[model samples]
Target: MNKNNQKSKDGNWQISFSPIFRYVAVFCLLIFATIMLGGAVLSFSQMKSNAQVLLSNVHAQTSQRIDESITLLESLASLPEFYDPNVPPIEKVKKLDQMSPYFDYLMICYVDSNITVYSDGSEPASLASRDYMQRLFSTGQRQVTDSFAAGADGVTLNYTVAVPLLDAQNNITGCLFCAIYFDEVVDILKQSAATSGYEATLIGSQGQIMSSTAGLPYGEPLMKELQNARVIGTTPDKLQEQLLAAEPGDYWSLQNGSLVYTAYQRVEDTGWDLLCSVDFRTAFLGILPSLLLVAALAALLCLGLSFLLRRYIAGQMHSVDLLVESVEKLEKKLYQDERPENVDFNEIIRLTSDGLSDALTGLVTRSVFLNQAETQLQKINPEYTSALCFVDMDNLKSINDTYGHYGGDVALKNVGYIFREYEKKYDGLVSRYGGDEFVMLLINLDDEAELRSVLEELVLRLHSEIGSAGQQINVQCSVGVSLCQPGMKLEKMIADADEALYFVKQNGKGYYKIHQN
Candidate 1:
């Protein structure tokens, strides 16, 4: 061949390969960009999920603590002794003083029909001017107050729960109340904030801060804080509307020139909200390591694809198609929200209701049980006795090992059904306290003999068989009972019952024992 012709063919080959290299580089860049974008989205979504879980856990814990105060006051109201006119004021005061330690309140007090407050170690003082007092006496209903100056110190911020004392005819007689120090609640928020890297604030219905981990003043309006910080996703007014309506949501904002992400949820059965906030930059950095790892893998994959494209130019189109498909699958896998946003108040309410009951056993969860049981315990007639029963499924582990977890689950379902029936029959409170254990509050039993009879029925009923995997598994529970008095604390009763249960487990299983203490 001529030298010119040879040179021309070599140049043409070089030009052909150059465009292919450009296309390969462009494709690799596209792949890298797609992976990085997906990784970022996934990281942000994950951060939000973590924040939500933290917010939810803190909210539930705080709400439960507040609910106990209400339950304590309501329980005090049901003591017939408190309503008795003949019971001297000094005697009532002494009785309240004795029960003070058990109630975990700053003070347990009695307010008569005249709205005079008589507390342990304090002189009689009229609470007639308190709005909560006026409301309870006028409507004969329960009241949970916002933070205010209370207790003998009369300077420390406190919240109060008051219930009207009703006589035999259901006529309003007086009020039984308890005061919860505000700092105790703030401690709960502080602990959560310290561990979770999110500052938490408890807000009352009027938008005032009840407690805050961020060191916001106790009575400052939340809006005032917002006014100083710029909200990114929505206006302060809109956020206030959401708060006023007790809606659950998340938002972005800028505080002191730093990006912030916040989530808020309404505390159930109370006119309060829980707000959790975290520094956006700091939280984003948490997931940066994972993103970098993903990016490194993507870069290596891009290099491999480049080599394949250079060697197998004929099948480059097919390789690109496969790459696109993989990217789409990754987008689907990475970008999912753990909890869908609630579009309306009704949807939020529905979601809240879903968590109140246990999914597998169809019984109230431990927290729900605590709240309901305390309220019911207070309403029982003082003339009759009540009992707290701790029930442990004796053969759950054996059943799980023998017939698999399905068999153990079948046993629990049966037990739950039985306990639920008893709850309806006795008008009692029943809860699945933990794995393979349950708690029941049997109210208004006439005497120890009556309780024994009821327990016998429960034991015999629980001593049945359940079918699992084409075989029968015997399911039995050991019961420990603690008789309850008017002034007894729920935790003390639980502990006593648990001790008795320990005795039954150690001596023999599948039987019942009353607490000796």
Candidate 2:
């Protein structure tokens, strides 16, 4: 046969075995495969990075919340009422409850070398109070006790704040101690998890989960995992060593063989940690299904185009374009649009806001006020003058006992309002320094006479208001005013004002005392 006839016969055979469309089909299949692979890898990397960032933020935020909670407790301990032996234990409890809404339970203990009293009521008959007291006295610092199963409450942990309560002679009378219920902490963690897309657990130094969201078991396996997790190296040296040495953050496959991303950090100042983990499958839930559909459709289109005319291939390509557009829209809505209800991301936003606000309020508590006052005095020029007024509610306990806590709250709120009003008038800062005690900052008040007059009139107004509320209420406040001088420390002014207040509290309830230079 001639060469032309041979070529025609070969073409017929080739067409019989596989159509020209088959070649096009194979090429399209390869292209779809490549696209799918690239998309999957990119999605995986993005999801992992996002998960890590979320966990990192959760860790930092949890640490801050813990610190703020601890600081609030410490401030409560520093109050003069805690040192006053005459104050009943129940009164102190009520006062603490009033001051801190976050505290679910609080206890004051005097575990001294000689005497011990558990101010939460009474010591358990089965437990040896003396032994615990000895251990506390020896430690001489704040510490968190191990988690133990308390009856009916399941498992509970105790965070103890231990400080020395000094006497007038400057001798340590005993260790002023408080116990925070771990359940409240756990509730906070769960609430955080519910509102912030990440799961959170408070890990102790011993690898025990001191608190965790509801339904998470506090078992050995979980504890071991937390202990082994990878941690941020920027943590304190000891913590860094613990985290690096531990196996907690290591990769683990679930029962069905899914991988998860994990992260953890040590809480600064507190010997606690936060651990967070999320499965990648759940992290990018909807993205995978859509990607699979696109790949499948591409495969089918390639198969059809091989058997049909070129016009069909063009139609298939248009369909592919529409599919791509749909996927893009889904991605944008899922990742970039406003968060949806019951979605993981919304929780994070809410929790972050709550945590930050709580932290700010914690800083504004008594210690920060005192520090700011000291800083202001330190930077004062010779010509500038300031007045410090220590305002004390005369009988907060009696009022609370007589009218209940709500009334006490109302009275305190009124007092805060009054301070705010005066603050506006004097261009000063008024802080609820402690329960039933407030500090007013009056700047550039050089006239001692004018300052005295202002304080007296304020006290008279308070008395008149209290009298109208109820003659029996007779709520009164005593004011102690001290003028800040050049080269004087803020504490000296505070001490002078405190002494003057003490004199008034002794001599008369509703009176003002001004300390002389």
Predicted model with the maximum lDDT = 1
> Stretches of candidate 1 above 4 Å error?
1-39, 257-259, 293-517
Model 2 shows how many backbone clashes?
A: 12
**Model 2, position 403: C-alpha lDDT score:** 77
lDDT of 2 by residue, 1-517 (tens): 0011212432321123255656776787787778767776765675556556655666656555556556765676567776777876556655554544445444444443355443344452222254334554555455444444443354545665455555566565555445666565666566656653546666666665667652456744353443444433332344445564553342333423455555666666455666665555655563667777777888788767565765565577667666656755654565465422223332322433432311211113466567667765664444555688898999789888977775676566556656655764565666677788888777765566667778888898666344223434546799887878777778898899998889888997798888886
- Write one digit per residue (lDDT tens) for candidate 1, span 421-447: 687567788888999999999887777
Full-model lDDT for every candidate? 0.78, 0.59
lDDT at residue 192 of model 1 (Cα atoms): 79
Note the clash tally of each candidate. 1, 12
Candidates in order: C-alpha RMSD to true structure: 44.0, 47.6
